[model samples]
Target: MTSIAHSAAVSAALRDGKPVVALESTIITHGMPWPQNVETARKVEAAVRAGGAEPATIAVLDGVIHAGLEDSQLEAMGKATGFLKLSRADLGYAVATRKNGSTTVAATMIAADRAGIRVFATGGIGGVHRGVEKTYDISADLQELARTPVCVVCAGAKAILDLPKTLETLETLGVPVVGYGSDEFPAFWSRRSGLAAPMRLDDPADIAALIRARAELRLDGGVLVGNPIPLADEIAANEINPAIEAAVDEADAMGISGKALTPFLLSRMLDLTQGRSLIANIALVENNARLAAKIAAAL
Candidate 1:
């Protein structure tokens, strides 16, 4: 394992026992356009701070795995071109090759675990894609959740996925999918997925208690806390589902697979929704960051 390069703030927070939240870098790299990406990253970090915790945005830069980035580093990354979209399989290679890369949810989990960060915030998790029986395409995020001991706070699995199967697979993997303040699992841009969440907790302290119990019981993995997007920001399921289906169908037609599939689908969805999806995505990510900060504080 590579030794992580920690920002001074992150190192101090860990030493002083202050709450700190881990944030994924792929959102800055793959999920949005340049200026907005950096702007949103700042906003998400601000949200985390407002909730009483410092945020550690994880990324790999020039052969070093950075557990947290400084502002100059974030700006450089946002403006740079051509970086690897790293997951569990490619993280070490990107570092060994002295290349830059953005951390996906799975990759972020690995970095957070290495740095001793216990919570992460992201837009949404990748999961079993639609029509996966043929592709057998399950996201490394799910597998990471089954083993990494970092609490992941997100809206839920990306709405472009097969939610039911994602939920089933999580259950089978022994990953607790906890709905924060709701019974239904959140669907990224939408408030509800129409699927009952396997577990529910309304308070951050209660969620923290669950995490602590898992540690005491020697459970190996983290919990997925589904924090719904604000009602005013949500694109209703009825309004968003068609756009999602069209995006998926288009990806199939274009033969976009693996890492390329998500960016492709998200870009298509943005076009189909006339950029409403991007707005919702920003809202949900900030919301998750706030919630994750609270959870980290609780811990």
Candidate 2:
């Protein structure tokens, strides 16, 4: 069996019964260039701390699932190359083979649950890819959300996905999709996805109560909190939609599907939007982290 290694901070937080937020590591290894990735990661961690929660940035290093990373470990992870983009399927394989891997939402949720952490903050969650009817390339993140008990706080599904279909799938899977202070679902870089949220809640304490209510009702899955990006930081939907379409088109033409698809589309959009997408991504991630901390505290 693969062992879990918790950083000192996370262990201390757990022992003391303090709020702790889980963070995914793929943003460091596959989301951006080295220095910026590391810098954004540190900023997100700081945001979580500022909200009075310890940040547990989860990843797989040398076969061990780490609930939190030390500063040096984070730095090394950012600079490392050839890391696997691990989800539920490959996470165990990476560990069995002693390979270094960065956890996606699915894998991170699993690790967070194992570590007894409840709240996870991320920029976006993977969902039904565009052309899913043809390609059938749904993300493992959706299924993870259906079964894992962690509460996921994200800006929303990435704009490149089929938002309507993703929401439909979540509904089918019985996952609660709650918008934080908005009537509409968020579209990652943008604040609106053009779909009404199934549920809405404004306060972190209310969300915490919802989580408890789910447990009380014996529901066996996670809750997704769609927190919109700050108005000042959002890339307007009108401005971002075209770029997303173009990038998706390019990926389809190039036959880039599966795990490689999201990263490819994101990188292409960065070039297409002249780096604005990355800026918005960093902002939204920090925003989500702060919200997750508050929810954790409320719980």
Candidate 3:
């Protein structure tokens, strides 16, 4: 295992067998504008703490993997620029090369599992892109879920991708998708993706039980909890789908693909929706954090 630097709080929690929720650093470095990104990260951590769990925001800095970040580290990461958007493929490369980088869902999961953390919270997991046939641009996140044991709590696949294909791929991977109080899988900013969730478990304790059951059965993958955005905070599918379509089309036209595609589409969404998308994103991320904390406690 790679050497990991644990923050004081995370070390204490792990030593004491306390609940802890893993958070990703890309949400701070690549997901939003600086101050809000830092502020939202703090709020999400607070939400975890409020739910009776410690927060472990994972990142890689100067050839070291950090299982938890301190306040100053969080601020620096938020303000830093030109960091790699790391996933499974390049996580080790960044560490080996001593480069600063932000961990995406896949990379975060790998790090969390290495640190003995079993739960994570994030805004959404990436999945099959719209043009998976031509581009084959699937995100590493799905594969991570298939092989890693850390449970992930997210709003769902990002709205910019093909939700149907994403769900199909998860099914093929044998990763359980559980809805947290909804039969339908959430579409990131929206409460409904119009796709029925494969399994529904309303209570966090029940979700924890499901995780335990999987462990007992010796399942190879993690569980995904599709947590919907709050009603007041959600941008209805009707209102947001058009913007998503437009942004995806524009990316295709502009020749943006692979790692650049999501950030491009998301930045375009901020412009097209006049920042409503960002507001919803922050809300959903915090919401996932709180729920993840509860699930961690139950576990």
Candidate 4:
């Protein structure tokens, strides 16, 4: 009666008790241009493999939620058009309607949890958008993090959002935000946000212990591991903030809102930063995938 589907690799990994890291597929279908998107996805998977875990790139294909995807399936989805960008709100609806879709952070967590996978890796998570007081456009990723038990590894909240408010919101929701090796929380492409992380734990084994302790204490929500982007690839906050601000102003001027806002802003930032943003993005995601695999293996 279970409606979920799993690729042979994932199912076998689960059966054999091997570590597996869940990857969000929106990174393929919506995060970038076709060829680069597929290419980055492959590289991310390779990073996870190199880190000693199987990678389960989660997505919904023709309305069926799949925990892992075949290479051919990934190829087709990367170039496919009109796929739903699914999050907590739309993931179930997409499945019921049999729609082709890419999973966001929240959707991936939901799928990964249902498949009994505990860890997920992603580029960045959505947060309180700039000017959220006027539009109240907080991302479902935050609330889903509060509800799901999966651990999500990311650089941090998207640099395009209001970091202070996003951090405050996570605190209010009782979600753990752990900085991997730094006191300051990361800001997506930047290594430091200038804001203190709620907690800091440097080693992956310590992080795995914290996750196990959560289970022992019967905690209900997820932990966010803020793994900073590698130093060589980072665009310092001073340099990236201006591009993000310019992109936000442009998005507001264009009246872009809801799901349309993120992709538009990201695309605009890529242009404003002369493609450095995208390069940093690819770097951070691969780094997160690498760390997530280690954490999963530890767990």
TM-scores for all candidates: the values are 0.99, 0.99, 0.99, 0.99
Per-residue error (Å), model 4, residue 145: 0.9
Error of 1 at 137 (Å): 0.9
Clashing pairs for predicted structure model 2, backbone only: none
Candidate 1 stretches greater than 4 Å from native = none
Error of 4 at 168 (Å): 0.2
Report the lDDT tens digits of candidate 4 across residue range 67-92: 98899999999899999999988887
Alpha carbon lDDT at 168, candidate 1: 96
* Superposed Cα RMSD, model 4: 0.8
lDDT string for model 1 (1-299, tens) is 56999899899999999999999998888889889899999999999999999899999999899977889988888888898999999998998899999999999999999999999999999999998998999999999999999999999999999999999999999999999999999999999999999999999999999999999999999999999999999999999999999989998998889999999899889899998999999999999999999999999
lDDT of 3 by residue, 160-224 (tens): 99999999999999999999999999999999988999999989999999999999999898999
Model 1 gets an lDDT of 0.94
Q: What do the candidate models score in CA lDDT, each in turn?
A: 0.94, 0.95, 0.95, 0.93
Error of 4 at 116 (Å): 0.8
lDDT score, candidate 2, position 156: 93
Clashes of 3: 0
lDDT per residue (tens digit) for residues 1-299 in model 2: 55689999999999999999999999999998779899999999999999999999999988889998999999999999999999999888989999999999999999999999999999999999999889999999999999999999999999999999999999999999999999999999999888999999999999999999999998989999999999999999999999999999999999999889988998999999999999999999999999999999999
lDDT of 4 at 240: 88
Point out where model 3 deviates above 4 Å: none
